[model samples]
Target: MKKILKACLLHSTAVSVSLLSFSFGVRAQTPQTPADEISPPVTDLLFGIERMMGSDSTLVETALEGFEEKYGDAVRGGDHIQGIAMTAGGQIVLSYSRQDPSKENCSGMLIYSSPFDPASPNRELDWDFYCETSNTDINNPPTGLGPEAHPSSLQASGNILAVGTHGGTRFYYLGPNGIEALHPNTAVLTGGRDSTGLTYNPVDRRFYLLNSDGSTAVGKNTIRLCRSDQDISLRQANQAIFTDSDCINIRDVYVSGQGANLIVQEDGTLFLVSTFSTRDLPDNLLGFADDNTDAIWGAYGTRCALETALLPGYGFRASFEDHIYISELDFSNRTADLVMKRDIRRTQAVQTCVDKRPAFRFAGGVATIRNGALLGLWSGRQNPPLLSLNDSYEFAFQDLPQPIKSASVSEEKAYLFRENNTYYRYTDSQGVDPGYPASTSRNWDFDVEGDDKEILGAVRYDNGHVYLFLEDGYYSRLEKDGSTSPGYPVKITDNNWPGLAPYAERIRAVINWGNGNIYFFLENRGPFGGTLLGDGEYVRYNIAKNRIDLGPRSIEGPWGILGDYDTDITAAVNWWNGKAYFFLEGGEYIRWDIDTDETAGPIRTSKYWPGVSDDEDITAAFRHQR
Candidate 1:
């Protein structure tokens, strides 16, 4: 058995039932016919149970009376909705598990026409034509062999409808013309014991199925990929195979004997969620929520039924038992956080049974509509309701403890090195506090030092590592977490090459071009300091070879313009467009072309870039593309 980790929301609160109650109105009526003999209503009225009929006879009767009054005409005696799918055109396709099996026309699937206005009391459904079986001559009837066949899951893409049957190995596709068997008996990818979930990826033009034995054990569940050149015939061609070893453990969560569901976003990111775990397949293992009780006789025997929906902006919403959780997924970190959670039971007296335990069985499926509203289906004696939630977790940037000395940015996050050798990371949306502190080990002891170890510059390379240049002619390579790389603080002295020894202590500035080259500015501050020694030299540090090239002698030619400034080279930054700009002491700057090894200007910074003040001195500058 795999260990189950509880990943509940950081702050759990009660959802307001009053808002849902106002949307769903109850009706009064006593069913005169048997459940299986009744026909589905064609009106726009909201149907289905809102609350469960607990052991309390008085409460159950009162709830039943309200349902009878509002939806008595739409309620079928034994009609139990199993699955639902909504199309882009606003059409709703519903599957019933306990439809009248005797009716030759009872296909267990119904199609509700569009313009399903929740405010309208007289909405209409196409009750004459079912999804699986239609009386019309143009559409074909369901291809299943038995009348007992019931749909377990339903999914829609454009006008195509994909239906999975309970306890059946094959899935069915319903189109404008008719219904057909999606998988043949000889197909390579026969669904598991029961096909619980089905989804279509428009990008790849393929269908994905979640087949499992209902065990939350590793390797007991499988995700089958179905593909076909034609729209009608689907064949199992492959399984969701992961290249990552950590993702291999994801199959364990599906082993739990509960129905599982899948959702594929427009970006081809696949999400699989079961009662045991929610996984962003191929890598991330989003932990599970614990709502199970020790009592077997409780409203929900063990665990809560689980379902997930992909909201806009990459937000993931999960409905586990009686609580709804909203989480933001960080694909870079391979982790997700439960940002907000709402427990529906807190606001409803009808949520618990006579035993006072929450009855999760009364809850139904959750679907996200085009307008971003969540429609929930419930069963028992009350009417289902619509819930609208603001599930977005906006990132808030926190103030840094100290001013940033130098900063570098990666694809997913920004790194800020503070004046105290402490570093923090800023995501595209928010800033993080200080992480691992910078390393203290030095390659050589400083001769003139009084605890003021200034960080001269910092840069993030193309290879994802960061380098921090110190004032003492030494540098340290830092890991993404800000910790010093092993054997760091390498001295700038050319001990291995003998060429860099002369300018070792005279190194004044450094800048990483993001490519494989790190450019160093060496100034000859005569023995007494402040005395200019000709034009300072500029050298290119070969990052891969870990050696400085002395053959070029120095940056002569167009680069020799920097030699005029001598020690006045104040700051340098690799701009977003890939060019390096060197700022001089008098607010004058020059653009260096990394590719051609040329200089563009001795232009005044105040004239070209007004944001940079001439009198204002900058310690360091770096590129940050958030």
Candidate 2:
């Protein structure tokens, strides 16, 4: 009697069992059993054995032969599989690209009935989803192919399969019947370009597209998210609608690299892999190996096939050309390590010479199977093969470094100031960080010693100079090169400013107009607490002349001219529009024109700034020009 092996296949959607049971001698034939009958641990052990012996071993080979004989050859003699996806019900879907690009009926899809069972017979069905001849005219009734009609990427969720094309021109979805154009008559997503990558985010139940938009000229390519639950067919046409409100803008997250592929880990963390250039990696969320060269070859027009996969117990694995780089990510520390590397050429004969070099062309597609095994497809091979790696490798991570407390940007660089009075400048061109002045002394100028006074506030001027406000009415100036200006750390009273003599000790906030003047908000704690000084004083410094001009005046608000014991000024910021905004302790804000000294509003801050929480305190705010 043959030994019957029962196993369960756990997937994102539904669970199923393998019909072809493994046996030493004759293959054991059994009806499919419910997955619940087998415990998870036992199923895992069985799957582990299967993985060790390899999916294409004699057992699977016999099963494949039987399947072809029963169901017809679903592999289609090894057609080029452009995209692979698994449904929630344990069904596998493969999108095949046009073997002959010039032929109209070359692109189609194959639906496999038994997803996790390698022994399962041919695909359940195969259909032509892409008709290039009919799609040649994009504006016609039949819905012809646009410039981006060549499907290059695909993602599946539930019962829908989303197909993306090159040039980011068109998007389509394949349902049970056939393929249908998404937002068919709508102009909602017409503006984006280069739709090379697609993924379904289970956490938010939305579809994300990695592509570039109209702002690509300025390196603003980004990840765009579409609502998954929408009735896409009913969406209106000619509506230039797009969602960037929650979309991840590459410019904001990464300082330099343009995004190529995006992956959302099981834990909801999103990782974007870079392509083509040697741009600096992001310091948050995503991590990478330092040894991996940044010389990925894809650009807008050039199609460089790069792919990544999330390992079950390991971190992430990415493939480019003939090399595969595996990384271990420590999300807690926001770091990644390139733990291992492998050359695909050594395992398989994958070379088709285009020039003098072995053409690995279009060989970076990878997917994970239900049994925690990795499946990869290369341009040289039509069928996806299992990629084996050490499952017991360990990874270590370093603690994430704390970022600077505050930052201000200028035209050429961004200055990040820490609480320790040390500052670092990052050049925009190269994203390189140049450390602060010698650590031995606080002052960059050897002539003067830097003060240890905690920084109260800081502001940058248009001339590239920064002014630092400190405790006890002392201030310092830092030039663009991170060096102190001559005669630094001067006392506010000694700067020849008038009207601050009485309230200089109680200064609360400072604002730099960025032109040539700086303003100060001061509170007066007069003699005997409730005594006769004013509510507060507003002082101005003429930076060019190194003197105070029109200040030491009583702060006036809509409530009335502020009296000595009135509400105090809590926060203030220069809006960079020749106006300064001040917040009061009572939650109201008033705007003052720096040049005219005229005041407006005692209105609620929330009234002017939409989306701001009412309970949020206005601590600090600044604006930067793109």
On lDDT, the candidate that comes out on top is: 1
Give residue 294's error in model 1 in angstroms: 22
**Separate clash counts for every candidate:** 23, 9
Provide TM-scores for the models: 0.31, 0.31
Lowest-lDDT window of 10 residues in candidate 1?
391-400
TM-score of 1: 0.31
lDDT of 2 at 24: 39
lDDT of 2 by residue, 214-320 (tens): 21111333434333232222111222223444233332322111113334444444443322211122122223344332222112112212211111111222222
Candidate 2, poorest ten consecutive residues by summed lDDT? 391-400
Per-residue CA lDDT of model 1 for 1-626, tens digit only, reads 00111111121121111100112234365312221111111111111111211121111111111222322233343333444544433444545443443444434543333323221212232321243332211122234322123444444443444444433333333433333333334122234433344444444544444444443222244433333332222322122221122121122233222223444444544444332222211111233233222222222312222111111111222222233333222233444343433333311222222112212232123333332222332222122211111111110000111111133235455333333333334342433422222212111111123233555565666665666666666666765544456776666566742465555555556677767777767664444566545555577777788777643234445366776665677556676455777877666778887677688777876565523345444434454532
